[model samples]
Target: MTTVHERARPAAEVLEWGRATVDPAMREAVGALPDPVRHIAGYHFGWWDATGQPSEPTGKALRPTLTLLACQAVGGDVEAAVPAAVAVELVHDFSLLHDDVMDGDRTRRHRPTAWTVFGTGPAILTGDVLLTLAVELVAAAGPHARILTSAVLDLLGGQNADTSFEQRDDVTLSECVAMAVGKTGALLRVSCTLGALAGGATPDQVARLGLFGEHLGLAFQHVDDLLGIWGDPAATGKPVHSDLLNRKKSLPVVAALTSGTPAGDELASFYFAQPEFDPARAAALVEQAGGRDWSRERAAQLLRQALDTLNVAAPDTTATGELTALARMAVDRTH
Candidate 1:
């Protein structure tokens, strides 16, 4: 019930820092690449000025900010966490580059996706280079680097299962949860872990941070599911109801599909029968299936659990407040 003012930076400041972190070395690295690679990766990050010169494409570097914040919260030096912070952001961008290709998505962050501009092969290679760079950055953190690699591997594993789930109708709720834990939770967990490592937290503290990140990550996915269905395109910057178009088996969809209700039957019928359903129809279908309400309520519950884990981490009062603000900002985000 604490107001945002009770803790954390004002939302605007946090957002500013988040955007600033995305621009530095990674963009420079991409710009330094030879020929088509530079142009391709440059365009992906929105750095191409008119005439395809390097201009800035903006991103909210949420992962890196979280890494730095968590490090500070645990009394770690933010400077010490920079490598991990940058590493995670690089990995995140790398994932996005490849994910767009795999999802056949044409746009990201309100711009044409790397694959869309660069073609599949070059985009894939671009992701590869970034991923390698990510590992190198993490490795510079010394012993903690191995854990970071494991986190990336876990992310890849989760992504694999997620894509596979799209084709399979029998995916259970537990399986969905597991997939989310990997797909989203892994990097977040690593972020906290690295933060605690930088801060010299005890093993137990690191574990608690991992749990905090896990719960938060799960909550994040649930919120994303909500946004995917109902968020405005101007705000979300993605095609409205894109999840439905892709027939993405988000948590809510899976819950409704397995509910054994009349609505569930209708949902299954419509989803399988329609190949080219639009946003309005998809929203109608989701409503009929009771997914809208169910998802909102479920996401709320997961958010509470996430907060509980943060509480258990028992960060400093200021850090706790900041994290709470972060939680609110994440779930309460309209954009």
Candidate 2:
């Protein structure tokens, strides 16, 4: 059992611990894949370069960390949640592989995307394989499988809406919020739910934890959208004003588009125009139209709500503190 003092470890420490606990199993799971698919998956995971040589690792492992922590929060053994953590991480990477292809993105984690390095069909097939692996990992656990499948369906629906928004000019803030909920919140919610279930949480406890994850997930999206526009390339591993360059109908962009301000109007004009419309100027107009500040404030509000829900969930003291710290980190991060 983790002592109170040990449980009170800092958020970064907790993340590292979660990574160490989950990575071996993750690697083992990937090892079972066919050589070609495994190579592409490994490259996408930053486990190796395209040549199959070991490389520096990437990803924050936030979802899996949340899974482990949520299990501990409910007074369950963290080891029992390892499979769940691995499954969630696989699903996440699967989505990323497909997303890069659909978004026409050429880079990820400061490296060429799988679709760019390999062929698009190969990258997409690799994503399918990873998703199938995720399902196989939990196939024997009926409730767990159901939970994961539900979340995946929601995620796919969200991705569909997101892609559709690119060709649209009339996306509302509410619609954008709904999309973020499905795309980001659904998986995060499932991470906590699966963890709590593995830890033997009461139904009420699972519900409360799920709510916490949902709110935090939405908050995470707000911060991510902000980073997409303004974050440093070195930190974010993406170009400056990347979202603006894509004319993405992100939360902030949608907010600015619907703000009823003159800056918003100018932004709509600039944003919907042809390519090469000056991403820096588009970013400035988003800020001018109050999108940036609104997103910042919304993120803070959601963080508070998430913490408050977590407090009511009757989690262990150590879990509460660590979860609080992680929640804050999720919103406060620049990348």
Candidate 3:
């Protein structure tokens, strides 16, 4: 619900600080890679174009911000947790590169995907290098190294389920929810736990922070599902009707299908009968089945749960307040 004129937000300052601190280290990490791989990584980060021209950064770096916020929530200096933040961001980018490749997506971050520009083989290799680098970064963070690897396994499991869902019409809401947790929640959970650990939080605090992140991650994905079905391509930085074109069983779509309404029945017929989806008609069907409203309410519910969980963990502080506001914004985001 934020507009351009809403200059400062609860999490804006901390998130901005995180993006500033992490970018330099993130760039250096990418720079450390070998030639062609480094070049591809640079391009993916929007640091340089195919011809070495400078460009803009790709995303909001939300995962890194969450890491830094977790640090502050536990009384650690943001600078001290910079490496952990960078690690989370690196893994996120690694996932994005591989996701684009796997989904055959042409664009990301408002630019042609690396796989499209550098060829799929090179892009996948570059993603592999990034994943290795991410592990190395976390290994430097100490005993928590196992956590990052575990999260990666969960992330891959989620993505594997997602791809499988594409070929089947019998996908259940529970399966989709689990897939979302594995794909999206696992990393966010890792980010918060790693940050809390680096911040010297106790085991109890760290585990609680991770739980808060898991709820936030679920809310984040529900909003993402909303965006996929109804978001503007220019704002979302993707093609129009991107999910429907791929027949992605986003939560809203799942909700509509299981609503048992006539519109839901009609939508199912369209999904099964058509060779290619018509974005306009499909969108209309989803709306008719109350998909958008259902998704919005679900996101709000998850956001509330995240805030409640966060409260049980940390004391009332400016840092935790900002985190609460951020959890709210995560669900309300349009893109």
Per-residue C-alpha lDDT of model 3 across residues 98-177, encoded as one tens digit per residue: 99988787878778999999999999999999898998988986877899999999999999999898888888878998
The global Cα lDDT (0 to 1) of model 3 is: 0.84
RMSD of each: 2.9, 2.1, 3.6
Cα lDDT tens digits for candidate 1, 1-335: 66434756765577566557545756655556677766666676677842487566657666777777777767777677777777787788889999999878887777777787667999999888878877887776678778988998889989999989877878887898889889998988887788767777678778887777777777788789878888888899867887887788887878778778777777787776777656576577667777777777766786788677666665445666666677777777776
Candidate 1 deviant stretches above 4 angstroms: 1-7, 18-39, 50-54, 276-282
lDDT of 2 by residue, 1-335 (tens): 97554658787887888889999999999988887899999999999999989998788888999988888889989988999999999999999999999878888878899999999999999999999888878775445798899999998998989989988899999999999999999999989988888889999989999999999999999999999999998888788998898788999999999999999999988678776788888999999999999999999999999988988885557877888888888899978
- Candidate whose TM-score is highest: 2
Ranking by TM-score: 2, 3, 1
Q: Name every residue pair that clashes in candidate 3.
A: none
- TM-scores for candidates 1 onward, in order: 0.89, 0.95, 0.92
Residue range with the least summed lDDT across 10 consecutive positions in model 2: 135-144
What lDDT score is found at residue 64 in candidate 2? 91
List per-prediction Cα lDDT, in the order shown.
0.76, 0.90, 0.84
Candidate no. 2 TM-score: 0.95
